[model samples]
Target: MKILVLAIDRDDDFGVKAGVKGPVIGRDSCLDAAVKLSLADPEDSDANTLFAAIKLYDELKKKGEFDEVEVALITGHPNVGVESDLRLSKQLDEVLKKFPADGVIPVTDGAEDEQIFPIITSKVPIISTRRVVVKQSPGIETTWYIIVRYLKEMMSDPEVSKVVLGIPGLIVLLYGIAKIISIKYPPSAQIVSSTVTGVVMLIVGGYFFSKGFRLKPITSLVRIVSRGLITFIGVVTGFIVMLGGAINVYLTLESIAENMIGGIPTSELIAFLIYLNAFNKYFILGLGIMISGKIIQEYLRRDPHIWYYIASFLMLPAFWKVIDLMTIYSNPLIKKSPETLIAGVLLVLIDLTLSIIISIKLREEVKKWSSASS
Candidate 1:
């Protein structure tokens, strides 16, 4: 087993709380430093300083040299008693004796990096870096991952996780409601609903972009590019399918006129319904995959497995809707249903199934790459 130690100065507390506990540097001193930091211009002292500590830990973990590593943060004022070096050395010494691992590493991001160097020598390796991913395992319990652990335990609440999920759910609900209302309302209502849905999708895209950019575990440029390209292809293909559906509808209408059929033929309507169903199926599958791709980008940067699991979970619901839509003509599952809706559902299902297969394969490839590299 490998041991990872985090030595944090008590005075560096910029209002963020950490998991590990240690000595106090006096509340007054902490307050004074925070006030100064707040007044400082052009620099974000809090996040940057915390980021330094996280960077060091992440780099070491990525090296994959250890069977297992536990991280801890030590807080206390080094200037309170003896020399700062001696003080940290003694604190670490006590910790090492208890753990007794093959190797001991101390990670710090304090103003006294140089001060603590002399104290930690060949026996303990001290490192500093700026690339860090702060997250808590969503527990190994059930299917519902309800909690999030952030860096330094600053945002460790389960409610935070719930809120994040809630936001997306709210967006989907509002869009659904707007769409339903538009059917009963005027042209203006339909336009407003469409605009609202587009805006929500954009916001969702932006959220994924930030996650992809900041997460560090996935550091592969090729994988990143592949994910983006796949989403783009999905979007383009979906558009083409929808266009084809429109053309099919026009051709069916013309055929009816040329044949001089007194009324709409059952076969023509069936064909139209099948094509329409196919169009909607592809459209929804593309949208879901595109959104999931954005999320996966973030996971690639940070923890790829998390979003992989999430996307897998969402795949089923989208697929179910498509199947239900397209089977309307052939199945009597939903009684008194117009064949159009059934056709749409069936068409969507086929596309969703294909996307699901592709997603699973891609996830396996990513897993292999991650394990080999980290």
Candidate 2:
């Protein structure tokens, strides 16, 4: 039986530190790799792992337990995840091609290196596994060193750092802002600390809730903005216009409430209709502009969804007319006009008919373009 002893460097300490490439086959070559690695980083555990594999190779040769015994060292990329594993797999294939071992004895310095065991076993059965733990001085200093090293690594990882560092940074920022506000307005100073604390807790809770639900509003917005600059600008402008309309309603809210006091049951309903009337025109106009920008963007991209946006844009005027009719009818104070009602109904029907016709025509054009492309 031919047996192969495999020494793994999953993080490519051999290549990165010693400037040696992978699949370092033969007893002599492995020894050379070990010497180079030791010279580069004397305390590297991978160097000890290589020496251990060489020692196992010698022992197996002396026992004559197998017809042939070969020791080889394989190195991976420094990236240490998919990139590292892929390199290890390719190097393993190269080693197997050279010496088709019936079984493999994997020698690893740590659990990270041992992760490649399943990959090796899929190609050849694992006869045994040797884990090389470098001997170190026993003391609190060593324990502290290990803890610090892992903490540093955790902070260096982007995903971990977001939670470990980001939340604290956010808290500090909020606290600073609260202090500035308290100093600027002394009368409200007493409540600032508690308010800041509540705000911090609320923000932190929201962050975790969004993470747990996999909600990525910022990422989605970025993706949309990346698709077209015009679309982004249009959406922002539309939002600003709608916000202005809402602000107007808020500023007039006290007067509207005063008018409703001691009035009929329909007084509140009439006040709501007035607020809607004040906001609907701006809303419809802003929404139409936003949809128009999207239509232009989709048209440029030759996307089929352009027709849907066009239809939506055409219907906005109809929606505005419907809101106007509702406001006029709900308030008894306004004189009812048959001519005004008939005009509003006709306008809605005209908008609907136009939308349907334009959508059908645009869809036919899109179908023709597709047919021509094919």
Candidate 3:
């Protein structure tokens, strides 16, 4: 039986740091790759994994348990996803072609590298696996160094930094703005402070919500912008409009706060209704604009989802009317009538009926589009 000791570098640290391309086959080649990698980055664990593979190869050869023992090193792309796995697969295939082994002993630095085990197992039976963990000094300095290094890495990663630093920085900036506004207008200080606190809580909650679901808004935005100029403009304009709407609500609330003689329940309720009315108007308009752009883009691309966008667009007016009615009914000071309620209900029913008809009419087309896509 022949055994091949395979070492993996899933992130291509060797190539990125030491300018060494893999598959580094044979004992001497593996040793050279390991030495060069270690010399390039003293802290990289891939070098230790390569050295472990070499040591394992020697031990197995010495034991005389196999007909032949060989060692090889394979490096992957830095992206560490499908691209990295593809590269690693190609390198592993190249190594196997050079040395046909009965079984493989996969050696990896950590779980990241171990992810390619299935790729290896598909080609050759796994005799065993070895995970090489470089033991570190248990000292205060070492612990502090590791902590600082990871913190720096987290700061460098865009996704991690957005939640860790960006959100907090934004919250601080908002607080400062609120402080300045309070100084300029003393009567609205309490309202501004409360609003800012609410905003902060919202930001924190949103961050956790996105994180929990692994939603990558930044990535999705980038993808959208890359789709075309029209889509990009629509998204940007919609967001700007929405932001303006939010500012409008804040200013209107501040003005209302200033005019209120006392913080009474009825006044608070009325103020909240006004805020909702403002939000509904701008938010719906912004969403409509954004969806319009998406509709145009999808229509041009001949995407089946355009029908869904059209349905949503048609429904927005009805949504707005419903919210308007709610605000009107909830406001104790505002005069409400049966005619207004009837009008709103009729408008909603019309919109719903039209949307449902459109969807039903396009259902067959949607199915055909989906089949073509598949």
Candidate 4:
């Protein structure tokens, strides 16, 4: 069996900064690049990665661990996130065709490089991953310098800056705009706030425009967020439905009060009471829809933990009904009438039945969905 000693550069910094292009193959090529980079920039992590990879290759060669073993060094596209990783993955695949291996020992210096773990694992089994860390003793000045450098870089990089500044910047802009639009608030405050907000936005936008022109894991994160938003919309819609039902309940209560003052018949009064008590059916339906939506989201995502959510949500209506019974006993208005209790029981039963039916239907739907997706 062939074994590979794989080295990765997720950001192609080796190529961009060190002038070391990849896929650099074989023990000699990998070692030469490592030595050159280490000499050029001692602080560069890529240099350390290369040194570790070359050492691993030499040791295995000296020991004769396997009959057929090969080492490879690959760098990704510059600036781009997951796209850079994708570039690395594609290059690795091509290199494998030339020197095919069964498994790999990946050498990475830190977590940034290791983020490509999934990409590598898909192509070849990882026997073990090696991480090489450089130790340093820094003076106070050096420590301060490092912190300052990091902050400068963070300000320069839009990917980092967006998270740090986006929310606050947007809030300031919105607040300023609201002030500008309002006739009641002081014009001086509005002008000051808007000017400050505009300046912040300009700085942020400039940084983003500068950096983003050059920039994907970012793309993956975006997609994940999009899915979460869709699920959230479903849950929010369910709540809105229930809110409408609550408004109806308030209106119904008002009508009941009017009837009490107008000397309405006893039969009509009982009917109105029944209708008032039954207003909760919409709430129950809304909750069921929300749970169903959550379950569907998990199921569609193929998450293995969805069963736990489903099981709990399935019993939610019954649990709520029990809580309601306890609440009703404490209330004097409904405690005297057994009809409300009977109605509650029937509604609870109906909800459970509907929940079961929907659960069964969703199971079938999920199965079909799984089959289609596969």
Structure candidate 4, residue pairs in collision: 81-216, 82-216, 82-217, 216-219
Cα-based TM-score, every candidate: 0.24, 0.49, 0.45, 0.40
Candidate 4 on 273-340: residue-level lDDT in tens?
54445455667777777777777788777965565568668777786676667544543344346887
lDDT (10s digit) by residue, model 3, range 1-374: 98999998898999999999988999999899889989999888788889999999999989998998999989999887899999999998998898999999999866667778989989999989998877783243334546876798888999788877898899999999999999999999999999999999987897798889988788888887787667788878999999999888877775643443233325666778767876888889999999898889988888877788888888998999999888878776666789989989999999999988987777678879779878
- Best model per lDDT: 2
Residues 1-374 of candidate 2: C-alpha lDDT, one tens digit per residue: 99999999998999999999998999999999999999999988889989999999999999999999999999999887899999999999999999999999999876577778888988999988987877683233335546866798878998888788888899999999989999999888779989999999998998899899999878988998898978888898888889998888768765654463434335566677777876888898789778878988888888867778888888888999999898768777666779989999999999999989998998888888867867
Whole-model lDDT, candidate 2?
A: 0.86
Task: Please give the TM-score that candidate 3 achieves against the real structure.
Answer: 0.45
* Whole-model Cα lDDT of every candidate shown, in order: 0.50, 0.86, 0.85, 0.74
* Residue 299 shift from truth in candidate 1, angstroms: 99
What lDDT does model 3 reach? 0.85
Q: Which stretches of candidate 3 lie over 4 Å from their true place?
A: 137-177, 186-188, 198-374
lDDT-wise, the better of 1 and 4 is: 4
What is the number of backbone collisions in each predicted candidate, taken in the order shown? 16, 0, 0, 4
What is candidate 1's CA lDDT for residue 14?
34
